[model samples]
Target: MSVLDQTRVDRPSPRPRRLSWTVSDAAVMIDRGMRHTLRNGDALFMSVFLPIMLLLLFVYVFGGAIDVGTGYINYVVPGIILLCAGFGAATTAVGVTNDMTTGIIDRFRSLPIATWTVVLGHVVASMARNLFATGLVLGIAVAIGFRPTASPLDWVGAIAVVALFILMMTWVSVMFGLIAKTADAASGFTFFILFLPYVSSAFVPTDTMPAALHGFAEHQPITPIIETVRGLLMGTPIGNSWWIALLWCAAILLVVVPISSHLFRSRTRV
Candidate 1:
């Protein structure tokens, strides 16, 4: 045989590139994220613990002075649940930032898997973590006298809203993570998220605030979401707040998801 023919015969075939993501790939990434959560004792503890402490603090320490035309525990529990979910989701920023800055992303790029799955994995893990923390907060709230008058359907609606909010916030955190240069910066970026609930109708009625603050609080994204959850859980008047809350979440996801994708590509580009 000619040398050219021999050279052709000896060459290996090219492997097909993974242009699309698979469920299994996403699941593997999710498992990695969950394992990280399990190994990080301090983060897991604080994610669950801080919300519980805040629940106790607000319910016992501040519940007496705050009047929302209901038992303070009942009035405050929805806010606490959102707070728990927000705090849990915020941790995703730190996790994603760590993965980005630690050279693991480069390792993953060498594999045949879709890189976006890494972010998806973090998002799903954050949702799961936040949901678990939210459940614990609800249980504690009930134990501490948070009584809800909602029917089964209302309970379902409330849960759906909470889940949607978690997902939206998780994406936002992912974007922040992608943008931050360090884990500390990522964590710092989420402080705004953690602070948002306090400014809304979470802790008190927005109307009770001064004119300037009340306008901002009532119009901000968090207030409508808190109002929707409160309405679903407590049988309070929701008005148009439910749909408005949904629209807010949808808008945020629409904006952030594409931005996150772009940032991920830019950051990982060789």
Candidate 2:
């Protein structure tokens, strides 16, 4: 062998230094993202407006004649809350999709940031937005005479259950962001979400539909979720329905997290 070949064989291959960041790093990333989202007043307004308008339009306008079993607003509020959770998650897709379309995510990749934090940061921000929307909807529900007579602990449990659903849905949005070709397509994901509340017992009683349709709707994912949540609020027995809700949330998490992370790596490839 030549001298160069001998020297090449002798040189040691260097390993990349592993990065070890503190909890503060994740906290800082989350806080920065949260602030950016809160600063967008227009976005905040639209997020709050859709559900509020729907609540008003339905409860006062069409709700009078629609006997949903718990009166108008009382029956409608929980369904709207679930819809609100889905709506809030869609914003995550929109924001992330916008960034990907505009090369902002690529720019973030070049920065000295934890790349995993990029998506999680957006998720935390979306959670904050959903929290605001949930609060607003609950306020409207109470004002419209939708009193939830649950104990404080049960109320807190309801919030926690809803929060899990929000996170799960937000992760789905992030997956959409990774895969969507256009912003409009990203926004269109909301259509499927919107269809869910209607197909379930959000706006009306399932018994009002035909027997076959009622059977399907009652067993589908959203019905048990809405039932358990509304039941808790009404001081009625949540039964096995709450466990079913938790199962749905857990199942979504198990499936989506891995699939989304894989797609995320492929799309970013950094």
Candidate 3:
């Protein structure tokens, strides 16, 4: 053998790199999640259509009765947008619960990929699904005289707030799904989320509520989020609401993501 060949043969082989999760793995999970959302016709229809119905109901049936010192349609549209986003994101809990209860997660565990991608895929897919539904609702709102006075920058800000809220709500739904024993139970857990807006400034000003209800509405996380979005979209005064909303989202994400990851690992570990 040549001297160089002998030296190369004597050297130790390099260790194989350990396989870890990658963006492609996450993308595959996301794709799977999106496909699941598409395949569930009833869920897709309700997530989009239910909010539209609520918008119409509030605008026509209740708009004249509620006075917010502005066009009721304009005032109520922001709340409906949040409502639409919340209900759509709440579906993530059902999906996650289904995955947990079914044997599919076990199959996923048998693969070499990180198990957390399953959760992340669901989260991203929910965000995408909710954003689409929100846009549809917003479009319908516009068609029915929901005129927004927002500038281009304000529109961007409003979108950012909505997206942030959706992301936070999706993760919260994931957490609920993780904790629930059954898909139905998981879905039931989201009812409070859907109901939260009604008590917040989403449908009416907080002060209009009785004193006890007003305190709860003014202090809750959803109120700030709705207010920030409303201010941005309608060019209303945002005050400190934008930061408060961002902080609420950041705090929830910070707390929930880790707990979710831990729960995923704990539940999946065999």
CA lDDT of each candidate?
0.88, 0.80, 0.89
- Give Cα distance to truth, residue 104, candidate 2, Å: 1.4
For candidate 1, the TM-score is 0.92
Q: Model 3, stretches more than 4 Å misplaced?
A: 1-21
Give the per-residue lDDT digits (tens) of candidate 3, residues 51-161: 999999999999989999999999999999999899888889999999999999989887767778899899988989989999999999999999999999999889989
Task: Put down candidate 1 lDDT per residue, 163-225, tens digits, no spaces.
Answer: 999999899999999889899899896677788899899999998999999999999999999
Q: Model 2 Cα displacement at 119 (Å)?
A: 0.4
Full-model lDDT, candidate 3 = 0.89
Query: lDDT of candidate 1?
Result: 0.88
Clashes of each: 0, 0, 0
| Residue 60, candidate 3: C-alpha displacement in angstroms | 0.7
For model 3 the local lDDT of residue 84 reads 88
Candidate 1 residue runs with Cα over 4 Å from true position:
1-14, 17-21
